[model samples]
Target: MWRPSVAGPRGYRVVENADAFDIARIRPDETAVVVGAFGPFLKALRGIGARHFVLEKDPATLRPDEMGHFRPAESYPRIVPQADVLLITGTTLVNDSLPGLIACARPEARVVLVGPTVPMLPDAFLDRRGMILGTVRVADAEALHEVLAQGGSGYHFFGKYAPRIVLAQD
Candidate 1:
């Protein structure tokens, strides 16, 4: 149940991760649209040769150092349709704008929902072709908070693993 602070003057706060989601497989050379990307994930994406269109309403949330790697899109509406894959973070606050993103994706696009706040109910994203990749479990949320506080982005997970999609309920 991770909550991303609202993108406004007051800024957002850190919440829990009872429902957080994680990344699965990211194929090489995929054109990925990342919504809510922050630190290490952005670097990993770049390392994989992923061309990204980042979406963020808050200018303050953008890190000056990382800006070199990503191109900020005009808006999610304009970016989603052009991508081959959509990597989304499940923020704490409910994002009503998500459906529009789903509607805009190409039919063949692989939509992956990441972060802790993602809903467990499959119906929330199932019909939209969304899939659960994996989740990052942090031993110290405070350490993460400190990193984010200093505008230090990116995370290094020990024994990080990719998701295995099980087709049948066996």
Candidate 2:
């Protein structure tokens, strides 16, 4: 019963960064609230010199320089509403906190859910205030399986087995 046709169409757009469209919108003066201490996104925000607050439960995920911008998870309700953009980790879905986190943002806030765990469900996220989904799609399942079995992370599989794809609501 291996029915390939049973899989639905790939309706969402694939881009470089999930928030590629909104990167420019993250200006120096505007506030960005990051739910997780994801490295690349943090680097990008720092490169932009944008004023941002990172809400992370684990301080170890943040770099020494990033400690200044770190905020406790309890502060999200107060801080999220003030952000012009929100970078939420897809792991929130696994923790059952995605809905609450998404609800904390203002109606017009640019919300981006990023990480390997993010599902390719555009309508579900978009309906919940998400503007972008940053995740990886397996290009070579065998290679990906091999990488995982060897304890390799994105650094090893990305571009070879699992390519980064930013799914957008089109």
Candidate 3:
């Protein structure tokens, strides 16, 4: 039942990039290592007293002075095991990195997949535990498409085109 087909604009089937997502509910004292460049989430985590960090693949993308602590993506294996929470963009699913990333995390760690690229299905992920999907239901597909064309992410189009929703296995 879960297959990659024509699901949204630009034909992203397995994942849902064309949808919208919302602000995540995070708790204080949770240590997180984010896998993508989601500045707003990091700020929110910090605001809630969480020790949040970023891991980017391209070191050149980081502003040396502002994000000096940003670590290289290659250290995922090392960082993931020690973190209490793991934040990742849904693009990980699109790029087929979700499985390996999930495998590297401790069973108790809250591994959350954020962004519109997450699929609603939880079939392939049956083996995993403590994994959460931070996704959204598309409010306005046309508006979302327009914003996406303009390079907008959840930060730019949440209320208009998308809203945040969380999914996890009980």
Candidate 4:
């Protein structure tokens, strides 16, 4: 089970069942973007048979394991209006990029922000046209670290946190 770190006044809450996330539902024709180069969510995207990804990496050389199945973008200002989903890691460092990316997303795009760093409030992204599809929480830190140290990705830890998918308020 996955749980959100910052829950309501009551207590910690599970957002989604461990088996609920079915990536096969996503159409193979839909384009998606994975911001940043690492994490479990990236692995999840890969398991869902996702292709046509847009990754952001610095000038440093990437290891073969780090690249996974994703291909690099040829240039910046990569306007992907054809994308059906945009998966992002919510961090203060990339706050400014959110609006721009949202603006570029197609009208039907479903935007997901994963990781412990994501803002707790849905209002933060409510005004945007895309749907804020919820997040995944790491319930056990020690296990998470162990998996990472062993070279594991999110797909390996999907049910570790009691993952939840929240539907943004209209």
Top-TM-score structure, candidate number:
2
Query: Candidate 2 — which residues are off by over 4 angstroms?
Result: 1-12, 16-25, 128-130
lDDT of each: 0.54, 0.75, 0.66, 0.54
How much is the lDDT of residue 38 in candidate 1?
A: 52
RMSD in Å for model 3: 7.7
Candidate 3 C-alpha lDDT tens digits along 1-170? 11222333222233333221122345676677788877666656656777766878876665554285587788888877767878888888787777778888888877778767777665555455656666777889999999989998778876557765555543
Candidate 4: worst 10 consecutive residues by lDDT?
5-14
Q: lDDT: which is higher, 2 or 4? A: 2
Overlapping backbone residue pairs in candidate 4 total: 11
lDDT of model 3 at residue 49?
71
Model 1 worst lDDT run, 10 consecutive residues = 161-170
Which ranges in model 1 have alpha carbons more than 4 Å from their true place?
1-24, 68-74, 133-170
Q: How displaced is residue 99 in candidate 4, in Å?
A: 1.5
Q: Number of the top candidate by lDDT?
A: 2
lDDT tens string, model 2, 1-170?
A: 11111223244456652243253257888788999887777888889898989999998989999999999988888989988888888889898888888888889888887777888766676554437777777889998999899999878987777766676545
lDDT of 1 by residue, 92-127 (tens): 227666667677889888776655455333444445
